[model samples]
Target: MSALPNNPPPNVSKDAVARSLAEAHRLTDPEITMIFRIEKPGQESNPAEPVKLLEVNPNTTASGIMPVKLMPHAPSGIFFPSVIVEVHPTELEDLKNGNLLLPNGWKVNYDRPL
Candidate 1:
């Protein structure tokens, strides 16, 4: 398989991948920054699932669009096509409080902050 971000072949562990992603929050900001994966169900290999990340930070402006970013993704076999959502902390709370809605098909991976 080509060395793509979310490609399969089982080269890395999910825990390791989560750890790597968790590091991103550290690099940016831990308290107000949150990151996690939202997988789009699809075939495991062909066409490579898009890497979806839901990033909630106080620094970013809230929007309805799911924008793509050139972020890093660790290699894995059982990887998924991720749907990342970036939102402000208030937005996240609003989502939890039923004031905001997550883009359709995009759900929080672990249901927790990363």
Candidate 2:
């Protein structure tokens, strides 16, 4: 489990994360699945929530992009900030090019390992 610098708003829910991941994965690849595990709050001792990289889809998309997700082992009472998982280098580029869509008020991080 890793730590995120920002925590998600209270309104954020696990279902939302699952749904978003599912949708994102579907857009990137149908066979991709996401696993999320949230870290305990107050654990980071900062505003950031820690998120870990659990798994990635084995199947690659036409652009050689793999679907990725943040899996937290245990979530605290609060929802942490949004973390972006980039399977390929171009994915980030696509995001910058407005080729991809993401939820509002969500922050994108390209630091996740491929």
Candidate 3:
């Protein structure tokens, strides 16, 4: 797996990366799922947490959007810093809209390949 510079945070250990990726993929299909490192929104200071597991729509060409599941609530407008492991070639433009949401205090850390 790949990540942005200082992405998982200096405190994030190698074991955490393995466990995080395993847990992230457990919730969705690995073939279509995207892994991300999201910054915590509030006063919380744990940067090692907040990895998001998102499912990519195979028919996203028309919609040009991907959904990330966090808790019970769903909103596409919460912008924050994040690192996306993989992105489809066709969806790069859509992913770059800069509107892709994460928690607060988060922004795109990197848009690298898986």
lDDT for each residue of candidate 1 in 6-112, tens digit (9 for 90 to 100): 54446654445555555755676665466766654453233344555677777778765455544344343325334446778777777667777655455556565
Q: Rate the local accuracy (lDDT) of all candidates.
A: 0.56, 0.42, 0.39
Candidate 1 lDDT at 98 equals 70
RMSD for all candidates, in order, please: 4.9, 11.3, 10.4
Per-residue lDDT tens digits for candidate 3, residues 27-60, read 5554554444433455224443434433343433
Q: What TM-score would each prediction reach against the true structure? A: 0.57, 0.32, 0.36
Candidate number of the best lDDT: 1
Q: Which run of 10 residues does model 2 get worst, by summed lDDT?
A: 105-114
Runs in model 1 deviating more than 4 A are 1-9, 29-31, 41-47, 71-84, 110-112
- TM-score, candidate number 1: 0.57
User: In model 2, what is the error at residue 3, expressed in angstroms?
Assistant: 9.6
